[model samples]
Target: MQARKDKQVNDMVEKEKIYPLIVDESENIAYISDPETYEVIYLNQAMRETLDLALGEDYKGRYCYDLFQNRKTPCPFCTNDRITKERFYTWKHYNEKLGKYFKLRDKLVEIDGKDYRLEICVDITDSEVHNKDLERQLSAEETVVQCIHALSGNEDMDVAIHSLLEIIGGFYRAEHAFIYECNYSENTVSNTYEWHRKDLMSRKEKLQDIPMEYVAQWKEHFEEEEAVCFPKYCEEGEARLPEILQGLGVRRHMAAPIWEETSEKYGGEKKIAGFIGVDNPTKDIEQVSLLHSVAFFVSNDIYKRRMIYKLKDLSHVDALTGLGNRNSYLEKIEDLKAAHLKSLGVVFVDINGLKYANDHFGHPYGDEMIRSVAQGIRRYFPEYSYRIGGDEFIALYIDGTKEEFEERLDGLRDYAEDECICDFSMGVNFGRGNVNIEEQIGYSDSMMYVEKQVYYGSVLDGRRLQHKALARKLVRDIEAGRFEIYLQPKINLETGAMVGAEALMRREGEDGEILLPDKFISLYETEGVIQYLDCYAFEEVCKLLQEWIKSGGTPVPVSVNFSRLSLMGSRVVNRLAEIRERYEVPPELLVIEVTESVSQMEPRALKGLMEDFEKYKFVVSLDDYGYQYSNLAILINMNFVELKLDKSLVDDLKSNPKARIVVENSIDMCRRLNQVISTAEGIENEDQLNILKEFHCDVGQGYFFSEPLPREVFLEKFGGHHVF
Candidate 1:
């Protein structure tokens, strides 16, 4: 009786079951198994329908693999790495017989004392909807790659279009694809390429005349920014069908514009690149989506291809020689100015005798002469050349330096003299420290003119001749203890004690006299002899400061005026770097003054050059502030740490209310610009100094502090004292 009761209870449990066993509730087959022994213990009703096996009869005692195939061992893909410790694992399997994707899932489980896995699988025949989308995307990618390769293949637009159509036809399994090239010269759209599939030439040829009605719609669509898609079904009934569709058996198609980017204003008319029509209807919706994708891709690819071709065309000729230009020489200079490249040398070269050759031998021979000169120029500076002017050329040598540049110039000059009856002049400029390319080129051009005058035996008659003589005489006079480094004391406005001194350039010719830079500066400006004089004076002042420092003298900083021309050129930075290292002096102790004119030209390039000066922590002061077009925004943007007010502002402020207001506003603006405003040219008296002090001028350098004195006199009188 007890045994009968236990059987009845077991029967009740079996009837209820542990999990659901309904047919409609299950979309996929489900089964449970012992992981180690690989025994199938349970099967849902869906499993029976999937394997065509009876749930309780056929697969009850079988291993999981036995249901799929009679494998000698477990499937390689079925492993703990994938299934163990995971709630579920899913994968797809393509069935040859069914021709469908079967999405399978394996659930991790542990039953009784052994680990087990649950297998669930769905037929996934409907999943092809998603697969079709993916396949369409794949086709799109393939078409894009093909179009890229075709466009990149050649410069000929017709051939590129032909290749593109061929690729489209083959990729989409279409019977034919053709491109109608719009010839703007003739104002007609002609067939450039007509690709036909095998065994379909007659039908494809029958559709040669694609009819105006179909093309008219395309014209209207492009006019209204509507893309032309053919076949009523693919167009979703939005577009009219092409008449060619009826004769050629073309079930679907896509057409896009092949336009030159600058077509409208350039008198280029609308071009109808021929339609890409697929002969057969789409097997699935995959082909339905191909139209728009291919249209956009073709348009974009054609544009990119055309641009590449145009670029190749532009980059072909030599800019300097007006011959075949080198790649990137012209490119690099513009790039450097645009801040794309650094340390570019702008080399200015002038043909020495091209003018003479043109005049004496007539222009034909002169042209030949110029060509010969160009050949020689090419041999030395082979990479970059530009015909900037008739007899002038420019070259941009990357990573070029003053020395390398000089060597190249000298070599080119020698080569020109040796090979022909002419000479060439060259100059190089860059951004080094406070020096910039504009000033470098300016100086270089001046030097070139000077050298040219010398070459032509006209230096004595040129403007530079007198200036050159004056510079030489001044240099000699200075060396002979005639030139003096006048110390204009820079005083702290509040303390009235000298903190620094500006080394003003003064000279006495043969007789006893005090001459300012103005008297000889214009002279030295000719050959850039001012730069030389500055170097000489800078060295002398530095030596004096060194001795003062060594003798435990007061720490006094010395400021020197730099030529606006020199400071804006590359040499200033390079030379300053060299001098600072050699002298082993703190950059703070040596202040280099800059004028406002440097800001007018080459602001962008100069800003980039400032990094070199700022690197050594050098003090850069705007010597003549409130001069020129001084924009507070622009001034504050520079790397200058000090703003030196012009002496004109300080000297006239007491009597001039307008000047006083300007000074006060300038001071306010400088405070916001984070600049220490120093005053120069302030030589009136105590009243001007008091006004400067009230304005909170940080430092003052002028006659009020102390009159300009020689470096030795300055050291002897105020070296030990706190001369402020």
Candidate 2:
């Protein structure tokens, strides 16, 4: 009995010694609680300190929820049902009451014949934070790789840029992502691209062409730190938000500068061309390194796109005049053809004295002349003018009216005459409703050539000399009766009867030789003296008609040719009327001949002239009708008694079937109109005459019957007979 009592005493001593050693001295939290009552039965030193209990303060019999969790009820995470005596139950938990993470081991135990719960916890706050950081780093690396792949694989810059922005915005949880290009020379910045969250509105439209001053602070930051990052966007005690950022609702932002490296041939400097940026990012605002990496790819793409655009521009632009070059002109022609335009106006312009200027004053002066002409054309037709050659330009206007085209042409002419040191020969054609562009351009070009010929002809045998000397010579020759008249008979094709005669002009040289009109007419026209010669010829014809009437000889109608320059005078028609009325010659006995090129005159003015001639009861004939730019509109609109096929059309009648067809159609068209007389000039043989007779032509005049004869020779040859 004494031995059993001694053993019991030793067991109690061992329990008391082991409990304090294992629980009281441990650094981890340890606690024992009654399972049924949910009360804490024991607390170790770590648990007492964690609960802020003073030394020796009693924790026994306290509710575990009230002590460990400060809860009024048992902890929902008690783990009582999960604990077993077989082994410790291990779990992890975050203790809100202590603001720490823990790994806990809990077990069921029996103490003094009562069941209790025991738990031990190890704090793991530092390790948990470290692990979370590692996860974020890996995710960031993956996102960056996606961005690089997107930029490298796409050939289209816009697509690549959009993909990159989406990737960055999605990874950073940003409300907006964008790029802004800087034009240092212009002192401007523009929002070139943007991506916004689904619920947010895009700010790109409103942010264009912003002054660089708005982002001066950001650029400063870029220069110093290679980026701009702000969690709250405050700078140097300035509490007020910048208006630009505030307008964008940007509470936090980050950006990295985009840079380009110049070629070593160009000094190899790095330039800040633009920036990539994000607004109001929800995460990773401090990851400026990612933005820098993206900026490198973005800069390369931007540089490549710009280089391509510049090369394309160079290909389509004239280097000296800044006008569309030949390539652009050809491309525009195709576009115009495909457009099926409602109306079109084309103007062909040629510099008249370019070759003269280049030969006399060097190529620089000629270049200046070309540039001046291009500038004038662009001023009127800004969008569609092209410099197609060294001294030639063309302009096209879609849906433009004839009147508008003529008005613009007049304005260009006045501008050239008043402002430029060079002269221009310009031709214009306007058509409505599905007109052929190539045909219109060809017609306008033909008209331009006609005007160019007139210009060259007016320059004293195509040379620049003292104008005073030529003027005086022309006046002396006119006053000396050196200008004379000749006649070419128009014959009826079937009977070979002379129906009429065309009066031609000749100049008598100083040595008594006959000079062709071409030798002096252009000079006379240039001196503005052709009107006097025209009046002279008309008066002489009136005299011959009056003499024939007094002598009782049969007289045929006589047609007199008038220079276009002479006809342009306001008093020219009146002068001819006065001479005809003074001589008492019947108006029907005299025919007035005007060349087809008169079609180029202003429509209103040409119509007025035709009406004035009709008012005088004069027979009007269209001369040289098939020469160039054969305008059917003029023939249909004007009241002409005769249409003369030009010498060129008749010359090729035997050799070219196309020419025969054209002539046949022309004669058929004329014969259909009011029985208009179709006269074929330059008939040289029986084959030509037979062709005209087969086509039922009305009049034939050429060297076939007679060369132009002097007045005395014509009267002597067919004095009494009207038929030859």
What is the C-alpha lDDT profile of model 2 across 540-563, one tens digit per residue? Answer: 999988988898988899999887
- List residue ranges in candidate 1 displaced over 4 A: 1-478, 627-634
Stretches of candidate 2 off by over 4 Å are: 1-25, 29-131, 232-242, 263-267, 319-323, 334-341, 349-385, 399-426, 446-724
Compared with the true structure, all predictions reach lDDT values of 0.64, 0.82
Cα displacement (Å) at residue 373, model 1: 33
Judged by lDDT, which candidate is best?
2
Q: After superposition, how far is residue 461 of candidate 2 from its true place, in Å?
A: 18
TM-score per model over all chains = 0.36, 0.48
